[model samples]
Target: MRKRARQESAFLNIPYDRRYESLYLAFIASLCAFGLRPRATIEIPSTKRRLERIIELIQGCRYSFHDLSRVQLDRNSPTTPRFNMPFELGLAVDWALGANPEHGWFVFESRAHRPEKSLSDLNGTDPHVHDGTAHGVLRGLTNALTRKIHDPNLAELDSIYRDLSKAARKIKESRDGSLFEARPFQDLAVLARQLAEERISSLRS
Candidate 1:
């Protein structure tokens, strides 16, 4: 289990709102299609401070995917910029720099050059830009993580994403809350892995 966890699990650090729903599901599908498991704070059991829980979760995974597209100001009251994504990215960065140098973290954006403008610290680093589309997310993941064998194309990812979207709708309709809720999120991850596995199996057969 330890070896499998280190080899397959990936900490997903993305926005958890309706606007970012498509990309969220895309990330799950793409990661699973690439033969990886996706982990998030929602599925992490409650223990101590949320930040600590986040760090612990990151420690468990060998890779992390961060989407910094929603760094702009919030539209609702107070109108403050959302920093959770970047803040968590910082946690992953620190962990990669100090404790676990093997931890791999990838940054993604909706616009081409926005990441550079938003975070000057990452000047030398290139954040994969997905242009806020589901296909874009898949493309970014393909570029970020290579799989010489079992590699998936946009069509395969689109199929998995559509299936996940249908499943997400059913999950939300049957459940009492949003997709961001703990149970709902966990359900999506589980279903994604299953569907992705099925897809890969079919390809092999």
Candidate 2:
């Protein structure tokens, strides 16, 4: 039963910060649009052991997306580069090779060949570059998951993002809070799923 669920879900491993908010939203929207359920550690409550929870998510989801774009140093802190994204990507790669070679994952980057400079061990592997934009992320995601999802094209993905953004704004305005907050994020996922269903229905009609 657990294996089945894992096969049906896709785990999202991206930087959890305001700078990545738009890309994150675009990823979620694109996944939902193509009928894939997106899961992330953010869905877990803060009270739990986060690392353990993240591992659990990685183990439970057959498909994972690791965005290695934000490996650079933070503007506020000149010396300290963020390593969480690559760290989790490493974990996922290890798990796939050790536990299940069939488990598939994609490495995402903002610029071409950037991952090679930061994580040279992944030299032979290719990452989908998003150019640090919402549209780019959507296109990268679509191309990466081409085996599982039909191509929605950039125009269709843009349409979905626009619709989802409008719905997300309504939710934020109604709640008067940050959409990335736990509850609001959950609501946004629900709304994305609803919108995806509506899209499918329209296509069928």
Predicted structure with the largest TM-score when compared to the true one: 1
> How well does model 1 score by local distance difference test?
0.86
Cα lDDT, model 2, residue 188: 71
| Tens digit of per-residue lDDT, candidate 2, span 1-205 | 9878887678888888767878888988887776667888778887899999989888888789999898877779467888888888888999999988877989999999887789999999989999999989988877887643444667777777888887877776877746666677677777777767666553223
Cα displacement (Å) at residue 121, model 2: 0.8
| Cα lDDT tens digits for candidate 1, 1-205 | 8967877789999988888888999999888888778889887666758877888889889899999999888889989998989999999999999999989999999998887789999898899999999889988988898766668777878899999999998898888548887788778878887887777763333
For each candidate, what is the lDDT?
Answer: 0.86, 0.81
Model 2 scores a C-alpha lDDT of 0.81
* Regions more than 4 Å wrong, model 1: 45-47, 202-205
After aligning candidate 2 to the native by TM-score, how far in Å is the CA of 174 from where it should be? 4.6
Deviation (Å) of 52 in candidate 1 = 1.1
Q: What is the lDDT of residue 147 in candidate 1?
A: 66
Candidate 2 — worst ten consecutive residues by lDDT sum? 196-205
